[model samples]
Target: MRVALLILAVVVGSVIFNFTTPFHLGQIASNWGLIDVTIWITFVLCGLAFIILGILMAWWIYTYQYQPGQLAEYEPEDPVLEGRLTILTTIGVVVMLAPGLIAWNDYIAVPEDAIELEVFSEQWTWSFRLPGEDGIFGYAHNKNIDIIANPMGIRDDDPYAQDDLVIETNIVKVPVDKKIKVLLRSKDVLHDFWVPEIRAKMDSVPGMVTYFWFEPTRTGVFEILCAELCGSSHHAMRGEMHIVTREEYQLWLDDQITWAERKAGVVPLTPVQQLGQTVARDNGCFACHNTTGAAGTPGPTWKGMWGTEVELDDGSIVTRDEAYVRESITNPGAKLVKGFSNTMLQLSDDVTTEDIDALIEYLKTTTPAVE
Candidate 1:
């Protein structure tokens, strides 16, 4: 009796706690109520099953308690009881699974007027691309990826790629109340694009494209998180989704340069800066850092930041001198940067002293006066 009573108390407490502190999903802006309904249905049905099974167990223990000289009766199987259980189980399962199937069907059937946007994921960052005036996407492949010149690897020869607009920053803006068909791709390993409030997520597998669609009901900023672990700097992979008015969205979109314009917009680099650019690309420096001074990058920006004072993780201030740069490259963890992880690997012996000097010169050219 004590054991049964204890179990009953636990079951009742759990149900009460769940009801009192129900999950609060803040500001759902998409058509994801179906998902919520499915979750609630499953939770209720499972809770009911647990209660019934627990009560049955407690009742049997109390009713069939061991008594002195009590005869033990063994009955193999009862066909009627089994039949009733099977029917009830089938009914419960159908009730739980039917809603999920319906939600899934709705998820895949994207609207015909939905705007197509491509999101490319890397080891620790995200980049986006949108179709230009033609209203069509250009062909892109990993083979054509040149981290410096052509990051998205839109084939230069392809006419469709000339006008494609690429955004290198983590923030992407979309129009409110518009159906957005998100197309996902990965440059390297596997990655998942997830926006919690929007209730849309899909895996970006290398060498293939995966997609999903959602329509924002309101205008607001939402955070984008990498749901899959990609590498050492996986935790730093974050982005922002800005849903705004149609006019504002168009203004932001128009400001972004097309692939052809980006190619032609490069400023002439000095010989030293040119060499530094080559060395930086060879060392994969741009993977963690950006030249555009964009925030949310894994590493600090290298553009026009020379001769500036930076605070280290240990509360020490250091000047951005040649020695500091060299030491950082040789022994990456010696002085950690505040608010950033030390995911950099020490340079190998193959990175000669001359290469280091050229990189330093390139960084100098990025200073305010020189730039």
Candidate 2:
């Protein structure tokens, strides 16, 4: 009696708890409400099975209590019982899986008028690219992935790439109520783009591209997370996606400079200037520092940095003189820079002394007179 009652209590308690539980899907901000219906269908099927099985188990245990003198039947196979069980199981599976298959059709069918949004994911950061005024995206290949000039691997000869806006930041912006077909790619290993509120996610695989589409129905900032266990710093691989009005989105997009301007905008430099840029690219300096003084980068801008009073992590102010620049390159850990991570590796072994001298000379030409 106690065992049967306990089993009955488990079913009742479970049903009550499930209904009253605070954990549930977040508010819908996209047009995929049918996905919720599909999920609920699965939950109902599983919950009904659990309850029925629990009650049946309790009834069997109570009715089939052991008897010392009573002999047990040895018949093993029951064709009628087997058929009924198989039919019921099949019905349950169909109930749960059928809706998902139907919803999947809509999930893959992107609308014709959707905008193309390119997402480039790396080990620890996320970057985005948008089509230029031509509404066409340039071709990209892994071989053309120049970290400094062409981070997106866009073809050098493609005229369409000239005006494409490439944003290397932690923020992704989209106009509300507009379908955006995201083109996902990765520079290294596998990664996944997930935003809980949007209820959409897709993996980013290297040497290949995967895509998905979503339309934001409301305006807000949504958190982006890497769903895959990518690497050691997978948890910290996060960013933000802001959905705003069309006017706000256009204003922000218009301010971004194009790839052509970034690549060929600088005039022909002197031999020393050429050497400095070459050495910097070879050492992957542009991975952090930008020549254009782009905001929200990892390292300080190289533009107008020379002869400037910069503060170090140790609360000491120092000028960006030749000696300081050399020290910062060779012994970066000795005096860390404020507002930047202590993540830069030592370049002493990478560059020669002559190369360092030319880099300093190059910075001299870039720095403008304060007056």
- For all candidates, the clash counts are 0, 0
Root-mean-square deviation per candidate: 13.3, 12.5
lDDT of model 2 at position 212: 79
Q: Write the per-residue lDDT of candidate 1 for residues 1-371, one digit (tens) a residue.
A: 99888888888888788778856566787877788788789888999888988888888888988899998799999999999999999998999899989988888888999999999999899989999999888899989999898777788888888888888877888999899999998999999999989888889999998988999888898999999999999999999998989987886776577888888873444445555766887788989987788898889888867888899999999998888888887888998778888999777678888888888887776676743
lDDT of 2 at 354: 89
Assess each prediction's global lDDT (C-alpha) against the native: 0.85, 0.84
Question: TM-score of model 1 relative to the true fold?
Answer: 0.67
TM-score of each: 0.67, 0.67
Give candidate 1's error at residue 243 in angstroms: 1.4
Question: Candidate 2 on 1-371: residue-level lDDT in tens?
Answer: 78999999999999999889999888878877878888899998889899999999999988987889987789899999999999999998998888888877877788999999999999888988898999998888878987877777989789888778877776777999999999999998899999888888889999998987888999998899999989999999999888989986885676466778668653334446556766776688888888787888888888888888989888899988888888888877777678788778778576888898877776676676565
Question: Among these predicted structures, which one has the highest lDDT?
Answer: 1
